[model samples]
Target: MDKFILILANSQSHFINVIRISIFIVMVWIGGLKAFQYEADGIVPFVANSPVMSFFYNKKAPEYTTYKNPEGKTVQNNIDWHKENGTYIFSYGLGTVIVLIGTLTLLGIWFKKIGLIGGLLTFGMSLVTLSFLITTPEVYVPNLGGDFPTPQFGFPYLSGAGRLVLKDVIMLAAGLICASDCAQQIIKSKNSISVNRAKF
Candidate 1:
């Protein structure tokens, strides 16, 4: 039993590290996907099939257009969200912010503080996504697919946007784990500092 406990304690760090690394990888990948036009094809289908996302699919949303600068011969960009409703702006703005948060968190340079922020954002998004799934059941089912005509959530069902939805949910879990670990470390460090000060 003593040996078992020792092994478990040692393995805990490894497990935590794995979870943190995975979260970092996921965030980086997502940021890359959005920043660069790489393999973004999946987003459209997933969005179109998702009941929640379908609303935003065919939106003739006005986008930022760029005009060539006469002198610099470079494109001048401007925001045209005025043409679209707040939904588009909110979604776009939140998305960009989330990506930035994830990137900063992944750096591990300011682990505790940034981890907490990332975790909160992830938790909020997860709750929102899950709630949306509950509110819009029809969107849970895919409009096109083979073999599995209907989405089988199995056991404790989860509403997902699509394949990517599951990924996001998993990523969200990773974020929470990272946050918890960071918080624990912060508390431990503060307690240690207090103990040393008392000795002095």
Candidate 2:
């Protein structure tokens, strides 16, 4: 038991690396999906309602509600509307950024500077995503009238979208951990250089 405890205590660095790889896998996979029409359309509510991102869309929020397309299902009218709204274009740009961040984060295994940038970027992205819970009305279950009182519909009750966005909290923490590790590495490298210089 003592030996096992010691082993686990010394594995923090390895575990942190694992977290970095995990973030990479998740970012790349989701980012790649953004290329699809369905994926592009699905993010309408979040982007349209976002105060920071709304400028990317031609159409406004609430207007997006009427044009919402079910995932993996398509309507010509909806597709046309999305095109006019720059949904696909924005999605492509966002996807590219996400993939690049992931690649940089993964490269942290070999290079600290790039890793630090990636880590901070990931944190920023996660913060934006989590903000959707507040900005996007679709994140919570609507008060759809039922025979009985819909007690579960409201702010405390999260919709599927909200739940999905909530998962970003983990990514937020992982980003900080990765950033801290990279920062430590950079400082250590600088200190080594200083020591060598003093010896000369």
Candidate 3:
């Protein structure tokens, strides 16, 4: 038991690094997906509903307003307009930014300053994503019992996309941990240099 504890303690830094890399993979993969039409279309509900992000869409409607479908309409007109209004471009741009963040974070394994900056960026992005929980009603499972206002499936009862966005909470925490670790490493490096100079 003692040996096991000691081994676990020794592996803490490695575990953290693994977590950091995992976040990088997730960010990069999801970001890359944004460049595609399907991915862009999928995020429409979340973005369109957000007070801060609604401007990205061509037509601004209320959070739950069902757009009128034209007669013989096989396609969703609102979504079509959304795609035409540079949704793909916006998604591509966002994807590029996310990929950049992940790249910087991965580089942090060698460069502390770069890593710290990447960590901060990742943390900020996580906050932005997590905000969707409050601003986007689609994140929750709607109550089947109607007539009255439908109660949302809150917290642990997150719907599919809700689960996806909620994972950002973990990413946010990981980013903070990585940034703090990098800062400590930078400080220790500086101190070591100072001590070496004094010895000379």
Candidate 4:
């Protein structure tokens, strides 16, 4: 475990590329599960809140309505957007771009240009996830119609909007780490190329 942590902490270009690939694969797997409601895994928060959950609950085409905010305003959850817009559209549109860029980084193909695009995509996801983690609870959970809504899990740490939000923050941090590493590698590669040309 120490060795594993040390490798990740070193945070080199190759290591960061591995991180990007791993994150994307996990995202894709989660999205696929969201696309098809398999068994519920407690680790996945979005899937639990999905319209697909209604199926698990034995409903006939149940609509996913989000909990209202403290201000009594309705909001759309992430699963709602995924269902309405179509998972493939969201996946290929944003997901494919990120994955392709990440794959390119790992392959060392067009490192500077592709890495820039990958870093940008990762940064954008980081920002979007950060917003979801921060703003959505204030806008949705208060409307669950209770002094205090029941947590998703039995334990405090395992349940509650705060815990879900914390997970998103963790994902955002991972994206940022990937982006920073890619950007640094891009710059370093450019410098190396220039140095090689100068030597020639």
Candidate 5:
């Protein structure tokens, strides 16, 4: 058991690298999807409702409520509205940033400085995404009338979108951990250099 514990304890660096790679894969895959019209249209609710992000759109909130393009289906009018709203353009830009961050994070295994930046950026991006839980009404189950007064519809009740956004909390933690690790490596490298100089 002691040996096992020692091995586990020594594996922290390896685990951190694993996390970096995991984040890289997720970011690249999701970001690449942003190039498609379907993915661009899917993010409409969160982006449109965001106070900090809404400026990217040509139209305002509530107006977007009328143009939502649910996955697996598309309407010409909805696509036209989204095109006019700068949805695709913003998505393309955001996607590029995400992919770059992933690449930077993956490079952390060899380049601590770049990895630190990537980790910090990942944290910031996750922070913004998690905020959608607060900014997006679609994150919660709506009180659609049914046979009975839907017992589960409100803030705490997570819809599919809410679940997706909530997962970013994990990403947020991973980013911070990776960033701190990189920063530690940088400081250690500087200290080693200073010590070597003193010995000369």
Candidate 6:
């Protein structure tokens, strides 16, 4: 056990590198999906509920409230309007930014400065995703009738989609770790350069 622990400790940096690469791959995959119409429709509720993001839709339009289909059933029309108003364009732009961050992170394997920038960007993106927990009420369990005293106005309980957003916390920590590693590398390189200059 002691020998195994020693080996693991020695390879800690390698493990961190693996985690960094894994995060980059996740970003690239999800970012690519955002360009599609299905993904644009899927993100509608999250964007509509967000105070910081609600303006993306045209609120004054007749379709903003509800639309009656040919069958005469009223349905929320945001999805249709979102599609028409270039939601896919917005999604594509977001995807591009995400891909750029991942690309910079991958480049960090060769350049510490670029890696540090990528790490910072990743951390910022994590914070944005995590913020949805506060702004998105859909994440919480709906109020279902039960007993008189026990109103099922779910607060602490997370829905399936909420759980997905929660994973950003882990990503945030990983970004911090990657940034710290890059900072250390930068300091070490500077010291080495200074020492070589002194020798000359």
**Candidate maximizing lDDT:** 5
Alpha-carbon RMSD to native, per candidate: 8.9, 1.1, 4.2, 9.9, 1.3, 4.2
Pairs that collide, model 4:
68-143
lDDT of each: 0.53, 0.93, 0.79, 0.47, 0.94, 0.77
Q: Write the per-residue lDDT of candidate 3 for residues 13-116, one digit (tens) a residue.
A: 78878877987898899999988666776776777777887787675655324542333443567556655666667788889999999888877788989999
TM-score of 2: 0.97
Task: Give the range of the ten consecutive residues with the poorest summed lDDT in model 6.
Answer: 65-74
Cα lDDT of model 5 by residue, 165-199, tens digit: 99999999999999999999999999999999999
Candidate number of the best TM-score: 2
Clashing pairs in 5: none
Candidate 6 is scored at a TM of 0.85
lDDT of 2 by residue, 66-113 (tens): 887887689899899999999999999999999999999988888999
Mind giving the per-residue lDDT tens digits that candidate 6 earns over 77-123?
74466556656677888889999998877777779899899988999
Expressed as tens digits, the lDDT of each residue in 17-49 for candidate 1 is 676666666655565554322123223333334
> Which model, 5 or 6, shows the larger TM-score?
5
Q: Given candidate 6, what's the lDDT at residue 83?
A: 57
- List residue ranges in candidate 5 displaced over 4 A: 147-150
TM-scores of the candidates are 0.56, 0.97, 0.84, 0.49, 0.96, 0.85
